[model samples]
Target: MKSRYIIASITGVSLSLMGIVGAQAYSGENLAKHAKITMTEAQGIALKARPGTITDEELEKEKGGSGLRYSFDIKGTDKVVYEVGVDAQTGSVLENDKESSHPD
Candidate 1:
C-alpha cells in the first residue's frame, strides 16, 4: 500500500509539471477567449509590419485598441530588438518600434 501511494504521488507531480511546461507556449492565454484574431494570425500581422525573429510574445490588456493587444519582442536581422503590438480584436498593428535598452 505504501509503494502504491508513493507511485501515485510521483505520477501526479509529473503530470502537473507537464501541464506547466505545455502552458509556456503562450503567455496570457486566458485572454485568448476575448481575442478575435488567433495567435497565429497576430504573429503574421506583426511579422509583416516588422520582419524579425520573435523572441517573446504575449497577449495583454492595455489602453489601446479594444484594450487588448498581442505584444511581440522581435530581434531584427540587424540585431536590434523591436516591440510590435497588434490589436487582439482587429488584427491591426498598434505599435512597431525599436526597443530601448534598459540598464541592469
Candidate 2:
C-alpha cells in the first residue's frame, strides 16, 4: 500500500510538471504567430536600416489589447540607442525614436 502511494505521488508530480511545460510552449508559439514577422526577419530589417545591431527584442502585452506588441532596440553608429515598435498583426513599423546617444 505504501509503495503504491509513493508511485502515485511521483506520477502526479510528473504530470503536473508536464502540464506547466506544455502551457509555456503553447504561449510561446502563440506569441510568435501573433507577431507575424519572425525574430530573424526583424533583426535583418533593423540591421539594414540602423547603423548598429539589434540588442534586444520582445513581445509586450498591452493593457487593453488582444494582440501583442513587438519592441526592439537598435544602437546606431553614433552610439545612440533607439526603441522601435512594430505592429504584431501587420508587421508594420509603428515608431522609431532615439532614446539616448553618446555625448559629443
- By lDDT, the best candidate is 1
- Summarize candidate 2's per-residue lDDT along 1-104 as a digit string, tens digits: 99999999999999999987876533244577556677666556556556586676776765323356566788778777887765566566666788555242
**lDDT tens per residue, model 1, 4-100:** 9999999999999999898767889889999999999999999999998998899999998899999999888788889999999999999998887
Q: List ranges where model 1 is wrong by over 4 Å.
A: 1-6, 101-104
Against the reference, the lDDT scores of all candidates come to 0.91, 0.66
Candidate 2 weakest ten by summed lDDT = 61-70
Model 2 compared with the native: what TM-score? 0.55
Overall local distance difference test of candidate 1: 0.91
Kindly report the root-mean-square deviation of model 2 from the true structure over all alpha carbons: 6.1
Q: Output the lDDT of residue 95, model 1.
A: 94
TM-score per model over all chains: 0.84, 0.55
